[model samples]
Target: MEGWLGLLLLLVHNAAAAKMKIVEEPNSFGLNNPFLSHTNKLQPRTTPSPPSGPSHLFRLAGKCFSLVESTYKYEFCPFHNITQHEQTYRWNAYSGILGIWQEWEIENNTFTGMWMREGDACGAKNRQTKVLLVCGSSNKLEAVSEPSTCVYSMTFKTPLVCHPHSLLVYPTLNERLRRRWDEIEQSLSDELITEQGYRKLLREIFQEANYLKSTESKSEEKENQKGSKRFETLEQCSVANNELSEELKRLKSILDKNGISYKNASDKTVDHLVPSNPNAARAEERFHLRGDTGDRDDH
Candidate 1:
């Protein structure tokens, strides 16, 4: 009996260990495991906010002429004196392609660059290619030039050169409220007793109070307008109802004076009146006996 009890305990322990091992395994489908799928699938991806300053990239393309060819053909010599038909190349950021002949850098709206044409495999080349560029906020490709033979220059517009303060980022309402609350808390906790501090605090308080007052006043004005309009509508309806009641009374009096009676089908009271004139009495009796046919003349 002792041996049997020990075997039973061992079997139970093994079973419990196997169950724990299964539970501890990572779930591949993420359907039955809460621990493995705690992240929400519907959550949106987080993206970095845009920089608070102007920044831009531009693509440029154009032709180039050598100094000798330009001077003879156009009477103006180009900065780079390449062979007559050599094409000018500039880096295109969008295409991720660099100009084979030139390398350039731009900083603080100033541009400087160097370039050279490919020659025969074993040839030494001159470093005569230089470039200058200028840019502004208008976002226009303003100019391109070659100051000397085999050199180039260009001017264009870029937002990145604009001042940081000019860029705007609108905060959400919750964020704005949180920031305002933080500011208020900070102001309340400050112990500085300077005149400037007092003035600043008073200004902020007054501004907040004024904003609240304006909102309240606008809402109250709107409610008052709505109430006044409703009141006017009710008064008009009441006056019209009174006029209709008076008209009905006048009509009923006219009917009574002519010895005519009116009754609704839904009325429980049944009243009969005797006509004073014999002719009217006969007509009334005929109307009651023969219904509407008594009122129609037989042609």
Candidate 2:
């Protein structure tokens, strides 16, 4: 009976060692091993977030603007979906959702329009609409029309989308100041601060901005005095003057050594001598006269 128990123990130990070896190296059993296959299938995956609308377009979010026509009324919500309604005497009946926000249509590094698709079915394919955003005094759904079968076009106008064409294109000084004033006004309108507080804030801003500062304000005179004090000591003034003189002398010596002579700087502003930002300046043609970049759509 002892001999039989010893043999049984030896057999149990051999079976455990073989099981451990298999567990340590699963590849030796081939890629068909169930344990290894299960682990390989359990990979971590990340879910992607939805795409975002442009800054100018995002400002109109949550507000639904409508355009009423003789037959139907159209509604649009920025960064959301659009819908059409049948104009009834009692209440506007829901026609159908025109389209949902998909992606932005960009041109020349600017978001010119938006593509809203996967909406109500027309016949075979689903409805789709292209919304064109333009600069205007206020937000309005200008118009809507069906260009092709089930394909629609919409024109939206808002001041928030107003921006210069390119980085090289700069707004006029009046436009810049107007935008600044609008920002201040918007703060007050939003009730972010009281009127008196905003006025005080404007005064502080004006004091900091050299060009905007009042001539009658003592702060302007103080700024002038501060600038003058940069060379308060005679020794400091002499050092600056000597440094400028030396720079000019060195520049002149180099020009003379190179056998190059230039006339004195012109008294005029010499605006023509300054290189243009865009060397080959091309004026944007009138919208009607321009070539069809395919962006043009009805309404």
Candidate 3:
């Protein structure tokens, strides 16, 4: 029984050792190796190598007034004025101890050139610098500087830096008047009236004038009729007043002869003295009979 127990323990020890060995072995697929960190092995290369040469340079030909070369040949032309002139300059790669120039060539509007720099003038060692130049128009070199030892860079301003078309001259008074007259003439030409249109306009004006005159005459006739009506009303009121006065005088005479005293009543008492319905009807009938009698006498 002890031998069987020892055999079981030995088998367990052997299995654990085999597991550890499998874990310690280097991964052939390199999926998970502690020595090969995930960051270093899985990460992709993103940064590019440093350029072995210098960047391209561009300049206008005759406009570079400060350009002074002793050993190098330089030529320039205005890109805007000419299309056949060469506009690019190259540096000799083997000429100067610090920098060398290469061949300069131009194709259409683009200028290409190559250059090499062996070292800097400030006691710097060989840098193996290369340069490229591209030609362009309307670009002005604003400044050039060498911030590092033997390294140079330049700043350029485009032709559109300043607005040239914005500059304007004020016109004279006569010029402004002439322009205004020109505009008026153009408008008249554009709105030209034909003979038929002119005649139609004249007819419309005449019709409008006649309509206005007719309306004025009608208004005047209405005013005259109204005034005549007012005059007739006044005459009727005067005749009625005269008749009333005569009637009152006759009444006074009758009262004197009868020896009866007359007294005026207040408006409220007079209003209360309105006749009854039968009395009013009798009075209206008598008025109609009197009117008929007057008509018969006139006839």
Q: Highest TM-score among the candidates is held by which one?
A: 2
- Report the Cα RMSD per candidate: 37.3, 24.9, 42.3
Model 3 lDDT tens row, 63-162: 4312223422222222211001112232211122223322212222122322233332445454222222323355644333345665543333444323
In order, the Cα lDDT scores of the candidates are 0.35, 0.56, 0.33
Candidate 3 has an lDDT of 0.33
Ranking by lDDT: 2, 1, 3
Model 3: how far residue 171 lies from native, Å: 49
* Residue 195, model 1: Cα distance from true site in angstroms: 49
Better candidate number, 2 or 3, judged by lDDT: 2
Candidate 1 per-residue lDDT, tens place, 49-80, comes to 21111223222233332232322211111122
Evaluated against the true structure, the overall lDDT of model 2 is: 0.56
Number of the candidate with higher TM-score, 2 or 3:
2
Q: Candidate 2: which stretches are off by over 4 Å?
A: 1-51, 89-94, 165-299
Q: What is the lDDT of residue 231 in candidate 2?
A: 71
Residue-wise C-alpha lDDT for candidate 2, range 1-299, written one tens digit per residue: 99999999999999998888434533423323334323233222211113343433455678888998886778887767777765553322346777877665533334567677777777887787889987789999999999999899999888876766421111212465445555655554533334554554454443343222243446755886777638768999888777656645553443343334434565321112211233212211111122111211224
Name the TM-score of candidate 1.
Answer: 0.18
Alpha carbon RMSD to native, model 3: 42.3
